[model samples]
Every structure is written in C-alpha cells, then in structure tokens.
Target: MMTSIESTPFKRLDAEGRLLKPAHKAETRRPGRFGFRGEIALTIDPPVTLEAAFATAEDGDAGLSFLAGSLSSYKQLPALVEALGAEVKADGKYFIYVSDLDRASRYQINMGGVPLYVLPIDDTSVYNELIDFLYLDKTKMKKFDTAEKLDVIADGAAKYDQAYEAISYEEGLKRL
Candidate 1:
C-alpha cells in the first residue's frame, strides 16, 4: 500500500475523513467517530450530499453507522449506528447524534487504514465529541502539528494537551 505519492511530509488528513496526504499545516483530515465509553458522535459537513449520506449510512461495511433515524435512538442501534439528541449539525437532511458506546466496537473492523482523532468539547467527554481527523499514518494523517499553540486548544481542549498545527489553505503553500 505504500507509494511515492504518500511519502511527502505535507500530505495529511482532512476533517472530512478523507486523505490529503502531503497536506501542509492548517490542512486537516476528516473525523471518523465520536463516542463515549461505548458511544460516539458525528458531525458531517454540507457537501457530502444527501445520497452520499444515505450511502454512508446504509453501507453495511462502513461500520460507522448503525440504524439511526433521529437524534434519539442511542439505545436502539445494535452496534452499527447509535443515535442521540445532543447533536446539531445538519442542513436539509443531515443530522448529528451520539454513538451508542455499548454497540460501537465495530468501528475498527472496517477503518481501511485511516487514523482517528478525538478532541474535547467539554473535557468531560474526550472520546465522544470534537473529533480531530482520520487518515493514513505518515502519508495522509500526519499533517498538522498541534504541539506549540496555547490558544488553539480551547476550554475543554483535546486529551493530548498539545496544540494542533493548523494552517489555512493559503498559508500551507508557503512551506511547499
């Protein structure tokens, strides 16, 4: 699976669960999961498209979703897609929810060589909200170096206690 295209240090993961390997600072990979001890939460952007959402939700192998219909079925999903009501990130048909921790051990089953990130929105739930991003280790996932900032980490902060190296698309080119 290794290749020259993935060897560049700038490549990295974006916040959309996609690979941007060779990505510079400020660039980010997408998140894969957001759950508690046995639960998770997810917040997808707008461009993913509704059909894509359904495809993501219906894909039996993705293992990221179970059977969420609303934001309140946390106790219903077997172990594929738990639902919650605390989320609020949807446009026309998109929605957010918490992963049922009890039934979330399936995420690792189909991750397909991607890294996962977890951020703390309230510190109390470090493994449930504010996902960092998922990507390939050296090629697609290791772009930002959030290890030197003091303000990037907010009140709750991520569990790592280090600042994420975030750079804007414009500033990223400077390093190239």
Candidate 2:
C-alpha cells in the first residue's frame, strides 16, 4: 500500500527569469514489487524547457527542478546548460533569438523592449554583427550600409559604451 509519492516540485520560468507559473508536482518512478510500476504525467503550463528555465535561473531565483539540480550538483552546470540548447555564435556570446511570438511563448522570452538575448560584446565587429543580424533587419529603419562600412564603426562605439554594463567576452563564451 503506497501512502504517498515522493515528488519534486517543478516550476516554470522564461529566459529572463520570470516565474511563468506556480510549482507543479513531478514524480520519478521506482521499481516496485510484482512488476507493478508507477509513472508521473506532468503537464507544464508553458511546457518545461531547460533553456528557458536556465535563462530564468541566470537572472535570479526561479523555482525550476533543473536549476535546483544544477545548484545542488555544482558539477552539472555545463551539462545543464547544454541541455538548455544554447545557440552558438561564431564571434562570442550565447544567444537565443525570439523569432516569433509562439516560440517566445514556449520559452516565455520577451520580444520587445530590451533585447532578451544574453551575451557579452568585446570587439566592435561582434557587436555590430549581432545587432545587425538580430535587430536591424527586423526594423523599418534603413540599414546602416555605407561606403566606409560606418555601421560597424558606430556599432563598435556603442559596444564600448556598454563595456561597463556588458558581460565579459570570456563569460559569454563560457555560457555555451
């Protein structure tokens, strides 16, 4: 006779560390007598994604089972991040582009306001490339193409301005 099932309370979070919903019950099955087995069917509101959960964890405390696992087991950060499916960039910084509202909803990532992608900018080229690839093309404003390639130059200046607040290049690289 089973009195109670030992379960881990699972919570959902977005990439920006926002609590998407309250904690839900999740249980792992254990071997039982006479081939009797138990299973847990967990239906997360926004669905459980480690990437979203991790992004949320990075920002602050978000009640997520995987984040809890990563914290409790210090050696699992790399594995945990990998499981989150971080996008790899050629220059630096890990990024996840919120392509559409549907995908954003799945991860609970925001599309407007400040950029939701996480990463650091060191060289101007990398910063320029990132902004150009992600934001510029989506806007109605004119592209910054010029004979002197001034867009890159201007972007470099902006990157420098963000130096104090931006994440270190090495740290961004380590997120992968």
Query: Could you give candidate 1's per-residue lDDT for residues 83-175 as a string of tens digits?
Result: 222121121111223232222221211111221121112222221232242111333213434321111222122223333344332332243
Error of 1 at 84 (Å): 23
**Candidate 2 lDDT tens digits, 1-176:** 32121211122212333333323212212211010011111224523322222111111222211121101111222433333333211222223322111211211112221122333223233324444544444243234223112233223323432222244324433433
Sequence-dependent TM-score of model 2:
0.17
TM-score, structure 1 vs. true = 0.18
lDDT for residue 6 in candidate 1, whole number 0-100: 26
lDDT of 1 at 137: 33
Specify the poorest-scoring 10-residue window by lDDT in model 2: 32-41
Measured on C-alpha atoms, candidate 1 has an lDDT of 0.22
Off by over 4 Å in 2: 1-72, 90-176
